[model samples]
Target: MNKILIIVFFLSAQLVYAQENLNFGRQKEIISPQTNTDGTFTFRLKAPNAKKVEIQGDFLIAKGTGPAVEQMKLGADSIWAFTSQVLPSELYSYSFIVDGLKIRDPNNVYLIRDVSSVVNVFLAGAGKADLYMVNDVPHGTVAKRWYESAGLKVNRRLTVYTPPGYESSKANYPVLYLLHGVGGDEEAWMQLGRASQILDNLIASGKAKPMIVVMTNGHTSNTAAPGESSKGLYKPIMMTPDVFNGDMETYFKEIIAFTEKNYRVGRNKADRAIAGLSMGGFHSLWISANYPNTFGYVGLFSPAVLPPSNAASPIYKDLDLKLEAQKKNGFKLYWIAIGKTDFLYKNVSDYRKKLDAMNFKYEYRESEGGHTWSNWRDYLSAFAPMLFK
Candidate 1:
């Protein structure tokens, strides 16, 4: 009887393992590497027998509006090396992949809570650019609540912002899901970006509509932001997509669910809109495009497109929603704006060309400044009037 019991336990364990393995499939997971020096870093992974490896991040996109300078070189020791001319001191995040699995940087000293996940990175600019973070504003409430994930068997915490009128009015307002760039948490929009104040000023003056702006953390994994240590450039291994995951695609999947349950928002796609900046812009382009029926408004600010068929990501194949009708009629507004001098400007152009190639109609505009908060603020100010009208 004891032997029979042991056999049953072993069978159950194997079945559980099989179920978990099936979900992960045969994809290889990514792992973050440590920094070596101030301006140089080595990715010490024995992926020699693998097919391909690469690194990428928001550090390049935030520099200018034209095109990001993504640089990578392999060392004689089979380690991947990368460098940049002016890596800012802001908390930028990056990741690496081994085979097919995604992972975080092993050398990061800076970390912030990205919803339920922890991100790694080195802070380059410190408190100089807290413009994207939330400060002690006069009026507003920052609510942190946990959401359940029955499939993953976990409860996740999500941060939300309710404006001044949120308590007095029972009216359901149009919801705009604002995402952060690489290395930034969901709080980026509320804090450094000053979204709450911007909206408050707009609404107070009757220039903008009163609505709830949801700022949720965008990082989907434990990857670190740019620069792990003072050695600086030596640790460029955090640039790959493997580390950042597919970004808000999964976060949205959960966040949309959470928003629906807690907030007074429009139930359908027409009342819901999405927008982001930099890495968040890339995510916006991908998510809004694939899920046209899910969002009536789509805004892209200083977005960086990967290239050619690479498009904006989530890979066109993965986005199963058909958008032909939406392109022609479903969308209320498809807006994109970029600074002429921004390094990501070319990416914006590339995205436009791609959109033109597909015959999708959109409003693409060019501005005068580079990649800075001034341009972003102006863009948001201009963007608010066009929403939910």
Candidate 2:
């Protein structure tokens, strides 16, 4: 009976191994976004029955208001191909439209989700984008942890990054609270923004100081990111409840308290920084202003300034008073950046005017793109180097 059992187990293991091998054998040899020697990229798609195929991506400059579109020529081998011009060193996202329906590249395995849309991505090396790449350097560790929120009355999720040597060293490091925009959660910064890679490269090069980065979900209604908490695998929406009502700003202290207790981080304001993009920028502005002594450094990237008229929360009240108090209390750095063509340009301009009227000090940077992740990532690379300096 033992011999028979052994034979049956051997056959089952062999079947499993054979199935794995068969799956590997079925992978195709097609490659998309092939980097050429001349710094151009070639995209390929195998669509035999399709009459026409086109490509839309960030690599091409937008013609008017819509995205840039380029036609791909179909070859004799039933493949569509397009080669781009000599492009700059950057990360690009693209999708193929086969017969008017857009889809990701089947040959490319790498992709990222922005809100609800998913697109394939590729990196062109040798310049500023190198900061987004995983280099041969001392890397930091990223962990997704849950902490109890006293104010929110629930367990919440946050992504934490510990700089290299943190485990072995006995020193407590400064902390940067990095928030994400609307529809984003704790995982957005590390996933879409490449925050971990940027920090790893910057700290390894000694451009930025070694510090801990805490990324939190700004949505107050949700316990965690979609599919990560009590909420099941439901579709994620761009708008959520209590975002602009200042609930998150009022409860942010709980995150800081949790970090100080759990991580090896400094507890004082001088050792803390807060920054975010778009709606996140709005949060940083209020969180830093309302709790004047909490964060020494504040950064806003393409922020949506000004509260809605309907917002009646006390946290939204007394804006000028809070700013005056924050200014009198003093802080290390207040940095603001916006793209030239951002939809919120006028809003940010009005915000600047308010700051100017009060003689509030801040450093402003204006770049070239509209509201985009590309701009945000660049802002982060620039902003991080100036922190804990």
Candidate 3:
């Protein structure tokens, strides 16, 4: 036993020495949800030079809910370290706020983009590092098909999610156009959110009505992208706006035309719905509002639609996003969901107030969590049931 103990200690020491010699940079650091008995996880950062750093993210960016800052300890060679307990069994996007500017966690491995070119670190399911795409279940089908863009003169990719019996069933299905946030693409929904599995589970459980979910590469051109932010997890305070009417609008129109013609789907706009999260949420709101005849159901989930300076909106002149002009012809269901603690919560509330004042009726559902996929999944699980009803 003593010999085995000696060998184990020796190997652990050697591993520690190797990690120290390699330095923090250019090394893979493992972090997971790491849930505790009390149902929280600690986010640990081993920064060598950070005078002051705090973990900020979509789920727990609120003051004092993040990583341990006051408890930060400077170890040998200026290694700054901190740990904080967070609610476990959920995905969270987090980054270190050094001094004041936001930066990626030097040790985090999980990264997913929310907008045009921006990314935020994410962790899930407390414990050891999870193999990327390791969780497998009978997932919905995801297909990437290329089509010629008449407006762009280039080929484009659009991702489509089909539930079970999509091929076997002879009947047409209702379509839901799902959009991604900035810095994301049509693939983001499949890879990052695991939408197909979520939908499949929902349908299998008979919780959500089965429908074809269409995800297009929100990137129409170089300017518009799936990732549209610089700082991850924080309010999209740092990205340029890509206009909704530009490639996004054209892409949607073309994709719809192609899908309806090729797939078994209802042609009537009344059978169509559009919804998205964050940046994609904004796209759904504006596009559906501008072209009310295009969709019968619209959902804005944690949408960002303040002034153009808010980063989710592009620069445009006095254009009417208010759809009171077509309310009579507008959507059958307009569902708006925003986390009560979401950064754009107030803005959404103000917009809802304006919507109410204009007598534009819609449904507002507030949740307890912030703008994370855990909540977004719940949003999807809840919202899809009401569509095409």
Cα lDDT, all candidates: 0.61, 0.92, 0.68
Lowest lDDT sum, 10 consecutive residues, model 3, at 223-232
Model 2 C-alpha lDDT per residue in residues 17-71, reported as the tens digit of each score: 9998987666445679899999999999989899889999999877797989999
Q: What is the lDDT for 181 in model 3?
A: 74
Off by over 4 Å in 1: 1-139, 150-154, 222-244, 307-315, 318-325
Best first by TM-score, ranked? 2, 3, 1
Q: How do all models score by TM-score?
A: 0.57, 0.92, 0.67
> Candidate 3 at residue 228, lDDT?
32
Best lDDT among the predictions, by candidate number? 2
Better of 2 and 3 by lDDT: 2
- Model 1 TM-score is 0.57
The CA lDDT at 213 in model 3 is: 94
Candidate 3 lDDT over 196-270, as tens digits, reads 766776677676777999987665653222233222233332234444544575356878888888789998988
